[model samples]
Target: MTKPLDLKHVALSDLHISLLNMRHKPKTTKGRSNEPILDDILPSIRERGIRQPLLVRPEPTKDNKNAYGIIAGRRRYFCLQAIVSEGGEVGGVPVCIMNADDDAQAIEASIIENMARLAPTPMEQHTAFDKLSKKGKTIAEIASVFGITTRMVKQRLALGQLIPVLKQAYTDSEIDNETIFALTMATKKQQKDWFDLFSTDEYTPTGEQLKAWLSGGGCITVEKALFPMEDYKGTILTDLFGEHDQFADIEKFWSAQNAAISVQADEYKKDGWRDVFVGDIGRHFPRYDYAQRTKEQGGNVYVQIGDNGDVHFHEGFMPKEEAKRIDAILHKKPDADSNASNRPEMSGPLLEYMSLHRHSIARAHLLKHPKIALRLTVAHMLTSSGNWKVERDYQRTSKESTDLSLTNSRAEQELATERQAICELLEYRCEHFQLYQRYSSPFNIEDVFGRLINMDDNSVMRIMTFCMCETLKNESGAVEAVAVLTGAKFEEYWVPDDGFFDLLRDKSVLNLMVKDIAGKSTAEYALTDTAKSQKQIILNRIAGQGVENPSPNWRPKWASFPSQSYRGKGSVF
Candidate 1:
């Protein structure tokens, strides 16, 4: 059945070349081994006249009168045709005739010779495979003939199905294989949209970022969804790989689920909870801080609803005094005895001892820095000068008096201008006052003074130490202590404003103010309420409203509330 080749009779012979008889060759540019022109082989063929002989087999009756299908060395045939077209000297191509019985054998021989020279590009290979498949070859049959895995063939076929633009991009090296794999998971519309973004936008996401964008960001997997699937009100969709299911309408699912949690929170209130505070959807109450209260203390319950329809029921958390009351009741202890135990034992003596030791160390440290102490002494001496009295008088006078009190007006304007210049030198912006304090650790005093003069660290530290020496009213006898240290009235310079009220959002600080300034009963009431309500009440008390005989001149000495203190291993002094 099979015809054998006469290898010994293969001889050099002349034959005309034509494109029509190369029917087995693919028409696509991707299928051709040397498309366009073989710039490298053309000149050499022009000089040496065709060195390698073209492998050919007798064509079927349907082919041209030439009656030969090229199996190998198509370059030799093309080169001779090129020389003829350019009106240069040309001759027939040498031939190695194969006695093949069918087109498959000739095509296989061509593929083997081409592969032995240099493997085709992936696109080219896929195109060839696709052409074979079109000619009624099975995937296994094609893989067997080509010496490639069936899986590889299938993968190439899938790549062959990619949109034309993506194929071009792959060939151009614009996108890698991983990105192409991700694009395969996308729908045609999604692929077009991504291509538009990639081509036109300045920021193009690739790899994982592109994958996340393609899969809706809010999409939740079944494992991550805390609520039971039976309770989920909306539909769910699965991924392309059948790996996971995601919520179809995350917002709708959360709405239904959070409503259920609200009912649960209300039921908790009916079950004798002191109060129930449910967090808004997408908010989680920090458990470490809010879980400090116990059940018997009449502590409130906090219910939180998460994005994935998860519900968290945190119960029995309340203020300090309420917790103490429950602790006393549970232990069957007397209230007075419990209150006495709650009070710090010998706190005043312990405080005094610590203060004495701390002050002694500080003084010894300051002694090492005499330049700093001298600056503080100078600031103290200047505090008693007539300039301060004149400055205060100028600041207090009405603007209406400025036309008449020319001397005082001139003094105040000069002083204000100088102070603003100093603040600017420190890179301070009043609008960003909060950020100034937040990033205070990165601020250097030497950097501030260096802008104005060639000041050393010693001079900068001296000026800073002098400015920092102020008597803040934090203790019971703080008023007397301030009067002795600064010789200034507490109510003379400060007043309430938006900034001051904003800082009172911290519940601990607001409650302490209510206890000390608005009496014990107001502090107790404010402690049990939300921080927002406590802040409002504190603001009202500051403005001398609702409370009996409120002190309008009760401004604290510090410009802002002190940040939470942290003492590190190194000495700050």
Candidate 2:
């Protein structure tokens, strides 16, 4: 053979375009010497310079020196010239030098290099391949020179048989590759008839419809199978004249196809996908409703099945709302619409319920523990802490039903009876006297002091304890602390009722409460039920009605001293 080609860095001034260069001139512009368009490649040369070397041959110059003729990279050569003309700096161009006496080899090298860089039009490849065929080169040899398969070379050559009008239309990009490939399957007469129809202003089928027109309807080719062909148990029909093969049984094909889709979904789930949703057949997956995410961020997979029995898996996608929440947390941005952002676990009504119940328990416990009450009163007086001016809590409720329930509670009744006893002991009474009112009694302060001095020390201390307990603030943190220190028993003072259950809005917390009161199985069965149904189950179990065990003394977590919330949020303690 031949010697291996040598590579050299040649100066830009000594390089000239060779006659074998495939794109040296526009193919449509015959009889004109216009330069090739340099707009697309100019900016790249200005910034990155020529990255790939040009293929050139040695040429004899009149000046007695060997000049280089460029067989490839002609566009790059024009880009360099434009840069130099604009006063831009360019270094010596890298070139691979070939033998001086081989015109066919130069043409082959030019076609291969151009095909490798930017893909040429199908018509352009056909013309170049046709020229090589005319030069007595076999299809296998042409494919070997270009490093491609023989079948690919033959397919490119087949485009040369198209009518001239269709070739011009393809060159002008008026038709796409799919339409041209489908048209290639048509007979010469069929192509002529189709072209005659296309010449008019009437409707013309293209793309998939064109393929359908070429092959009659309901003919799905074997090339579209996502599963193994060996697994198909049905008959496969072959159209030898058209060179098309298709599955005959549509139902059997879909069964195998759907089974393949499920296998793919299971694999994705095993690969750490959070969800795998298989869409209905023939329904397009709505991409706009989802956002792209990484696999590590709990992204899900979507299995889309087409009407033609094709399957596609879209991985690493999440719903738009969830993706926004994750992105905001990752990027440290604020997401106003996210419920998990800055949301309290307990609701407003739940907070009010905890506060009022804890306040009531604290007051009742203080009534019995006079010593703790004395210490609490002195501390409040010394620090001026928390409504120390002897102002009673208004005990406001959002709902009238809640107020009625609280007014009839055991703790409220005990406190009212004790206050009546204290009023009698002090001999101070008025019809208008109320627990939450200050200075509503008609008796003077001097008379009350005189009555208190004559009473026993224990009796006077009990009166002082009552006054302190009545004046404790409704939602104060100090009341929660005192309730804990005094060891207040919630079961002895409180019970669940409709007013309490009505305020229980969160179904999750209600489920936990059901699990606590009823058995775990019952709670699990009731998890899917509505809040009203869950509340009824809780009521039924607590009342020992239609249940094995009665939890009559059961108290909510929030009712205890140092109150604990079911959701672990908005607790005063």
Candidate 3:
């Protein structure tokens, strides 16, 4: 037997969309279909004075007390929101509050209620199933909940693997089911290339043609082989539609080709070449970037492998810089005035010893005068003189979603705003300036100096601080030191999103996060659960869903200023 949900009336202002809602999409996801139409529902609700009650749970975080997160009836909530926006007088809307602790139950109720009202789109279904899957629900269990076949559930899950653009394209009805399904087989690079072609007026393959394109234009024919055909140990694939025979195994073909390349490299080495460098497959060797050089002048052999299995060797070539250096040495115009040898009196070790001691004395003296040190630091950033070649940190990440997450983060946005303000203050025309752009236009030194001279001391300090922040190296000891000194709070600037959760794979770390948010007892109970289950528990607690007391503004240890590992084994700081 189950207890009934408590029925109540909640004000529209107190309700918000929940993270658990199946229809809830992150703002980061662009080109998504518009929200459900409220026109039809608004008219009916306005006339009849409301009908069905919205299903909601207690707001997940303590920051919003007395508020509720709508798990079901999102469209109705939106309709009510619209009505209020239009300055319509509305009373407390009817609501049914579910147990906030039971995330799985809340999710199930949301899905069931949505299904009862209207069929969700395939992408929406995928989003729901993906959440369920992350909550430790098996494929069979999810299928059972939705009353669909396991195969259908799996098909929905596969949609999660598609890139955001492809997903958006499918949602926009620009591409059909067959085209999308075929694209699933394509690699990220291939999908990106295909999408680039599709976005233009170029001929983009579709459906069966896409499948053929993914198969490297219907297999690697023997005539396309860079190595001897007899050297390949794999069976040859014969195409009935074409006259030429193809290689059955792409891997095997590459192996023979690579072996042949190695042999050629060795031959070059034996033929008095300085060095033989083999670039990775798909890498292009730019001949125009290099200068032809004789073997005696430290020329090297460069082997480039094309994507289509073609190989080309660039012989007797060196970098333009190296060529110039060699030319300078060979075409020397000696100074006839004196015969003094171009040699230093001090040995290398002696010079290094003296330099280190001198540097130590200067550093010790500089450490005593904090104000002087600050001025020197500012000077280094402003002029970029001596060894101070200040450059912005790249903040590189392999995952596209993670990269996007950082780009769209509140912290990044705040920095951009600050940069724009600074640019305006400096009297620069930077209407379209991006703070992190690789090749931003250079500021005129005279114009900048003239402006800075007129600014107040505090204003100059702010500019200096921003410049230091921009050039600060990421993942360095300086970052940890500064974080500790400043008491930097990451939670104020960052929140967990799909990108953060997707990158988490360690079970131990996930369990630790569970303990941090849900408590030791809950963590112990879920110790043997799947990584996905632990992750959901963490998210639920963060949202203030199922816990008695939720940690507001909760952040993982790794996201902390001086990041720490769960086991204290791999402290990145």
Candidate 4:
């Protein structure tokens, strides 16, 4: 009933062409032009005489008895048909016969041949790829078969998901890559919401703007919220990889969180803090004008409440006017301490009482001329001069020549590193400027002067955070507050090596810190030895060497000296 299929049965004869099989593929027709492409193809084909063979498959009896479907080379089939119709001198057209069982197999062969040789239209590729995917081909396998990347395959599949109208625009090259990526996240309803604007307007958002617009006000993660979990009256949506979960109802969460924060601030105010400032939404903490004041000044404390229930307490800072009033009180000479000449009474608070008067007078003058004070402070910090200089002063015992070049190299390296770190943090870019330039250069002048004048409230606050972190002496509370608020942890980045430990001259402080991290037994043991031996033992513990039982799960915690530690009970300001 059926003839055996054989590859060697190829021949050179044209039977009646099956119109029934060919009708389904009007898109894969001969050419784009209205006129027949046969006009241009005929002369060359006449000389060449169909060097390549047509691929045809045997069709059943019902459509046209003894007919064959043209799987490929439709142009050649048409050319030979034209010659036959015109009664021209043409011999039999060569063809490779295929015994394809059905129309789907025939259609697949035609698609594969075309896709292999020519670039298909977006819709054509979409149709083909969708079929392959639906037939259970993995993205990698499809990419391998089509000689494309997995990313390209994914993009094409994403493009295929677009609605018919948008897909048609993409086919006509109306939309760009960024718009496609942005639109990929938009649902049909979301697209319809902006359909009028998309269809009519000449202007359309493409990159980050489009993404932001599609994403709404964005998301708040669990770590950044200030309110307790019990107070959150909203749901959360998880990321695809389950790495993070974001608040689904962002507005609801913020409303509850802000109310809680306001109550907390009020509680702080009622507890007798001079002043309190709450951070605004999507904004940084505010900086006090007179942030550098003495302990007696009763500095204003700042509390920042994050959306995810993170509370950062910044202590020991105050506004300028409040600092001035407190400075006045501290400078008021204490009625001569009636028993000042008495030996035992003179030993303790009375000595501090008299010393405070002299320091306060100097501080009053410095506060009056803040500009000069800031310049002098900058000088001290930069050159390690005055009280800021910490390098041990030893007599020059030998005639080792002072290599000024080496000194300059070290200074340049430190300055360059600081400059790069600041620029990276601020995302500030300036052309034709060296970050390590000397003060004589115009760039350096602009950096120091222009930055002071040009800083906005937000920029000023950010700079204040950096300055407070670096220059606020003996105020570890403020440093920890800034670190908590900004997510900048010193221990996370810095290594605790011998050079760092060498600066800790206070043996008591060193022993306390060692106990905090390495436990009481390790500290007690270190305290029994000399300070130098204690320092070595602590360094060994940090490096995880030479210690028999190292502290398990040890992480460095920088000390923050509480204000109460420096104040005596019942002491008057």
Candidate 5:
């Protein structure tokens, strides 16, 4: 008592505690928000000294004006306060008087300290991000600060809001990233749909089944899965125990009859996939008695034998001899009513895309710049843009689009830049494409020639999009889309349309009908027979210019069209 207590080495419980003159921290529980581990701290403090230090501020009350306040370690201070109630010898704990003079300093210090030492779990990270997300932080800002991709950040953040059971299971490694991402795409009800499967001993579902279920995309709850087994098509398949079921009551009837029955058809033999699912599932499989002849294969039919490879069935074809006899026009088309194989993806949307493109092509035909018509179509290599692996958005799948890893930092930047380029290119091309169609249409340009070219990637894409969609409408005083194409000023300078029609209008090699949208004239240009003879050479020059041309796609195909046609068809549309 006489000598001053050395603050260096003392139990935290031996210290007095008080709240500082600071704002309430009710919001502190958000995102890695530190809380007094009241549960652990109090109990642990009763047994030993606090292992960590807590930051404190000077109290501002009149009575304790000079006394220190607790800025942090409130949880630690609380444990000591509890100990002092238990008649603990609370005195002389070491304290570090922070130099923070204001509340802002205190918060900044706290954040800095936490950032320095606290490496939160993914869950914790997501929680922190969630708080910021609510404040309207964009993905770019999040990515820049975290040095991670927005996609990754969004995924983790989404994981935090999942059901407690799913979240816990995920944290414990019961599930996987793909499953979680797939689940994220589902609604709460849809998520509930699979809850029952997760409840019992058979919680684990095959990857394919899970994917199929999730792809249905709707509200799914637990109650739905129990009564009716949702078939592959998300339809109810009841009387599940009946004859038409995938399962059979062979055990009830067969008793102990271990029947060895093997059935085959010529179709499975012809598909050359004889070793595929059927070979193993059909051969050496027990007759569960559930057999349904669903469809025809190559020249015959197929049947399920028993449960094999995560599935069971008793497969064998009836009317097998007749179906297999005629190999003349056999096709592997299952009966319409059959529910065996899943439906191939619907192509209606694809048809819609074709419809749109077909409309565009028609518009292109009526365009002032005419194009060539090949006798055949070239096969296209389609890749999904999901991974950004390819340039085409139509070519990629979701998974593949996500998988497009940039080659490096520079490549990532380039990809982003290039994507922007494509967007802008669409702008110009769409407008230009539409402008031409409106000015030139329903006319054949078998004899016409021209090529539009561009060096700027972004400008090129704008041109392409213009071609794909329609040309843009500039402000009345704004530059004409055609002017950009022709490299001309529109102030009454002799900047004729300078496009396909303008170049081929009075030319001898080609013929085209063009109405000057600028109120100039409607004229037709036809290529002479001599020019047609040299069409190959002329076409090559235009093609070369298109490939390595000085001008942009804006130039009318006629303007870009190379003369001296000794080779082939020139740029028509």
Candidate 6:
């Protein structure tokens, strides 16, 4: 039933090149084609001829006997078929006789022959390398054959180094190549989260654009969004709430706030284009939630911008087991500051944050929405404006770090710190609320700072000083002085040496002042609760304490409040 001939000529229609074989070809005909690119060789081949002979070998037919298998020269085979189909005299085409070693060795010989012509594209080279690697070829051997360095070979190999899950994403049209490359380059989870949040859409994105999104976060999208400036109406709210008698007095929201605050999760979430929502304040914390989604990039999440401009880096999600290890380290802090220990360095606000996250490539496989590594612990305060989109991203500046540390608190000093914090907090007063034409936050953190500006530590101390004066008028000289000023005479009350008098000075107004924290002897001047709350952050971060607790409470220093617009036919919720 089968022909036993070494060669046979049927019509071009009778012979079809095997697509599977062509795809698996050791040599890509498109590349390494000494025959010239089609655009260049179109004229010549049309005029002259296919100088090289096509390679083929005899094979046993499935039905019975002898036939031929293409050892190589797939292009020549096609060329001959085309010519003969057109009724050209192609009956006597020259062909190469070849022998086989092993299947892989045979493929290598075929690949080598093509490489002698011209080297292929990186992709082609990559494929060939993979085949050779499977065939037990070394990088050195492949490089030598292709006349390339091993580093080049390795870089190409790196392209295929994506996680299996990510590779599946690429296959399923969930992600692209450049994004994979960006993920490859990411050193932290936050960076990875940026892409994951941005890439979460149904459409397929080009690899190049995905890479741009992964590297720059919202930079590309922001550029596009900003272009339609006419569409973006920024109504700056001057001061919608007037410095009123009732609202200001009854609600302390206007008098207390810090400057830049942040909200993230224990697990990293995908956040790209999102809206900021602000919730009520005094139901404990009427606050705004800053949320984002990353769709284009994935892998790690890292955030670093420290006191004294020192930059730290935090990695992506951590498993529950790892988080426990971190917790164990936090229990035995040496100093009160909680900022100075290396053991606790794995968690909290530090130079290297690798453990706060709760998700991982391995973990993502089991969970749809795991706990994020960091989320701001604020009462829902996500104003429309608070929903800040991914604006842009940059590499952490390593040089910005100032190598300083901090310490913890003792009982008396702790009391004093808390008092000072409270006193300072009370100092903030609304001098006047500028009437605004509109309401609603135009910028991200305008309202939080607006309140912070009115709070002067000294100003609050003066108020407390007056209040104390009236409370202690009947107490006579020293006791009265200690109750009012908390100066050197009053230091005897609550300060280290002032233990006996500390009771009389217990609620003194002056203890909470920032000026009180100046002395090294915290024993002599206990920090007020308000003082500890306010400066505890700044001092622990920038001032650098000697406290031994490595894991400190991550009191996010970025203070920003969202404002709602009431002028646009809406009630101020």
Top-lDDT structure, candidate number:
3
Candidate 5 lDDT? 0.39
- Give the number of the best model, judged by TM-score: 3
Worst 10 residues of 1 by lDDT: 431-440
- Supply every candidate's count of residue pairs whose N, Cα or C atoms clash at under 3 angstroms: 0, 0, 3, 12, 94, 118
lDDT of each: 0.56, 0.73, 0.75, 0.54, 0.39, 0.37
Instruction: Supply candidate 1's per-residue lDDT for 429.
Output: 36
Question: For model 6, what is the alpha-carbon lDDT of residue 280?
Answer: 31
Question: Which tens-of-lDDT digit does each residue in 1-573 have in candidate 3?
Answer: 787999999888888889999877657435544466665457767777668899999974566588999899888888877777888888998999989888777888887766544456678888888888888999999988765668778777878777889999998789987688667656688889999999999899997577667665544567767677889997674332233556656788888988888988999999999999999988988755676565777889888877667777877788878888878898998866578777886999999999999999999998897655555565456545467566678788888878888889988898888888876766543324433334432333344555676676677788788887787898789988888799988878888887888889999888888888778977886676667767767765664443456566888888787677888777666
- Candidate 1, residues 1-573: lDDT per residue as tens digits? 656553322222234322222223443544545443556567777888776667777554443444565677665667777877888866555677776455555556665555533334566566666766776788899778765568767666666657889888887688876577666656688788888887985787676455555656554556655446788776664343223555656666666566666677778878888888877868956533432444455668877766554566766676556556666778884566544656666689899999899989998998897665654443332232323211112223354333334433443355445445444534443221211222122223343323424444554454343233322222435534544565554344435554456445666766666676777866774475556556555555554443457576665434222212222233111
Clashing residue pairs in candidate 1 (N, C-alpha, C atoms within 3 angstroms): none
Ranking by lDDT: 3, 2, 1, 4, 5, 6
Scored by Cα lDDT, where does model 1 land? Answer: 0.56
Off by over 4 Å in 3: 1-388, 434-441, 544-552, 569-571
The digit string of per-residue lDDT tens for model 6 on 317-374 reads 2334544565578675567665766564344554333432443554565355322111
lDDT per residue, candidate 5, 1-573, as tens digits? Answer: 223222344445333333221222444332544334455347656787676666655555555445665544555576777788789766555555565355444443343333322323455455556655665667666655544567667666776556766766665567765565555544577667676677678764434355445534222222322122332223321121111212122222122111212222333445442222333433653222212133343222333333321223222333335434543346565567676567655488987887899889876775643222210000000111122121222323354323332222343454445445543532322211222322222111221111222133344334344332222232322234444565643222212221322234343333221111111121221122223322322332232321234221122233322221212474232
Instruction: Provide the TM-score for each candidate, comma-separated.
Output: 0.34, 0.35, 0.40, 0.36, 0.27, 0.28
Task: Give the per-residue lDDT of model 2 (tens digit) for 484-563.
Answer: 88988877887887688868889898999989888697777567666776776776566555455678788888888867
Model 5 CA deviation exceeding 4 Å by range? 1-118, 135-139, 142-147, 160-181, 204-209, 217-573
Where model 1 places Cα greater than 4 Å from the true spot, the runs are: 5-53, 57-64, 82-91, 96-107, 172-174, 218-573
- Runs in model 4 with CA error above 4 Å? 1-51, 54-56, 59-94, 97-99, 102-112, 136-140, 149-151, 217-573
Question: Alpha-carbon error at 239 in model 4, in Å?
Answer: 12
